[model samples]
Target: MLLAPENTRFSFALLWTLATFSGFLLSLLFIEIGEKPDIGVLEATVGGFAIALLQGCLLKQPIFCIRWILSSLLGWSIITAIGIGALGWIVPSTEFLPLRILYGAIYGGLGGLGIGLTQWLAISQPMAVVWRWIFVSSASWAIAIPFGSVVGIILRRLTHLFLGEVMGLAITWLVVGILTGINAHKLRS
Candidate 1:
């Protein structure tokens, strides 16, 4: 019997997908139950940080884990602050749904950029691998928000109000996972 070569890329992607999915689901549940937004944020932060640490473990790089944790936390905080600050200005309180979605996509992309840059600086991977990391992370984040918003809109139309965003997030993370896996493999090679 011949065994297939171990693909760390796929493993990393799968783990990331599961972690993000779980975090989004938990946030949705809290939203449905009328919990505070802070709870959701906290849950998501913890989940993301935990998953990042796991990735470090898989890569046998404790420095990457620590950097990821710090970077993720800082990136999220900065983005969230910017989003709130810009909400009334760029995405007025009375803005239409589509506009809001666009804003989210832009914000997500920027935040992802920060995370990607941090990953590149901290991971000590080859230049190409680091570049790929930046590109994939930024693109995934940028695309996910709008895609999720669309899903949410459709679900709302279908009267599945709560699940729409959740479904959108799932789809986004699925794509991210696939991309991450591919890149991980490439990096290994």
Candidate 2:
């Protein structure tokens, strides 16, 4: 969790939005232009680190910023890999779109929970408050699944196939992250 100052929720939200947007663009450029998913992953990791560092700077917590960077890198990578792997395992060979979506939601929720748990631990906040935060994060992540699928489908139909999917994924994360940030601000209030 970020150690933000008073009345900085809006600023934090704006920072997160911009960071995610840049991350999305960087990832797309890596994959589409550079033709490398590995590079895309690296770019995403650097973006996460940038977000963490910026948040820390805004919050006036330099030490926590370093922790956040490492945490974000490890947390994001592990959670995404697990979620994707689980999705594959859970809905293997499924032709039914709904079932696939359901599997996606489940895995996304699980990954979100894991990431939130780590954040809660890092912040060392009260159990009650952290539990609510985790729930909000997980729910938002789960909700992104179907929404992302819809966005991906629509974009693919309207544009280049792979580029559309990348855009959908980026937009999905942007929406979910913003919603989660807003909810977190509400909880803080």
Candidate 3:
């Protein structure tokens, strides 16, 4: 298989970011329909679907697209379910920047592992190259969440915006898309 072009990688990142952001906004509407845990699962499912659908479009092999989407949905939902179940025990409530970043990294890493493992099934690559994806995915989210959360908090406080969380999520997705996009290109190449 030929390597994916640079523009294609960029397109993948851009689409992934937009789709995820939009999915998050749509998921927010379901907040009143269920309990917090249920809602979190719902959000993860929606976000995963949206993200995978768009990201799959950029895949060199069209045959794997559906598998990609399904795997992502399953991965995200399962991970979110686990995370929700362990929320209080695994992560503590804290406003401290360092703690927040640490917790975010931990949470993001686990979530990334879940998603990466599932998504790995759809990737057509050697084990050596593909295994790096799991780490890349984990690191991407590990960095993105904390940076986005901190920025979102600061922006919310400074502007007093009601939907400042959206901004933070946007930043998070952007970072994720960029990091994963580059790695994906390298993997495929």
Candidate 4:
């Protein structure tokens, strides 16, 4: 019976999806309370963690999945994909690509680092810097965005016919990193 599973068993993706749905709801609340919509790069990273909180209701999470890297990757990837896409769609851009793939590198790097941190802490960090809190806000993004932006270089290099040489990946990395770092620092206080 130990190996036999019932339909009651839920997949990790589904659980995460539920958490994501909850975080999305909270994001709307942030906008509503602020009375204005703002799409900062780190918004997704933080919000993704906020989504993770919903897990507390379903399981005794602080549950470790694949040691550390996967957790960091999931956090950063979900954050970047949702955050960047939303920003592009919600905000009007005079000049910018709809989706920035360069963020993958940033996602990979920061995600890697966060994984290291969590592993070093054994995923037992306190709730104030809670996994859930990271989901719905921009804190984690602030920490990871600059690193995420680095993907732009590879993107530009590979797609020479389109983005060309003026994409400014360097600037994007610098700005996103500084801003995300500052914002996360502020939130931590």
Per-prediction TM-score, please?
A: 0.68, 0.69, 0.78, 0.33
- Alpha-carbon runs more than 4 Å astray in model 4: 1-3, 6-12, 31-49, 61-99, 108-116, 119-189
Candidate 2 residue-wise lDDT, 1-189, digit = tens: 666665477766776666545554554433332212233344445554544454444333555556655765665556645434321101123335587478658766886676666666445456787788788767876777556655665676688565555555666667766766665543333
Candidate ranking (lDDT, best to worst)? 3, 2, 1, 4
| Residue-by-residue lDDT tens digits, candidate 1, 68-174 | 56766555444445442211012122226778477657765786776677666565667878888888877776776566556655665687565454455566555
Model 2 C-alpha RMSD to native = 5.9
lDDT by residue (tens digit), candidate 3, 136-179: 88788788777766776677678897345457656777777777
lDDT of each: 0.54, 0.55, 0.65, 0.37
Off by over 4 Å in 1: 1-8, 23-44, 84-101, 185-189
The TM-score, computed over Cα atoms with residue i paired to residue i, of candidate 1 is 0.68
Error of model 4, residue 169, in angstroms: 20
Which stretch of 10 consecutive residues in model 1 shows the poorest summed lDDT? Answer: 85-94
Model 4 local distance difference test score: 0.37
Q: Which candidate has the highest TM-score of all?
A: 3
Error at 125, model 3, angstroms? 0.9
Write candidate 4's Cα lDDT for 64-96 as tens digits: 433333454354444345433322112222124
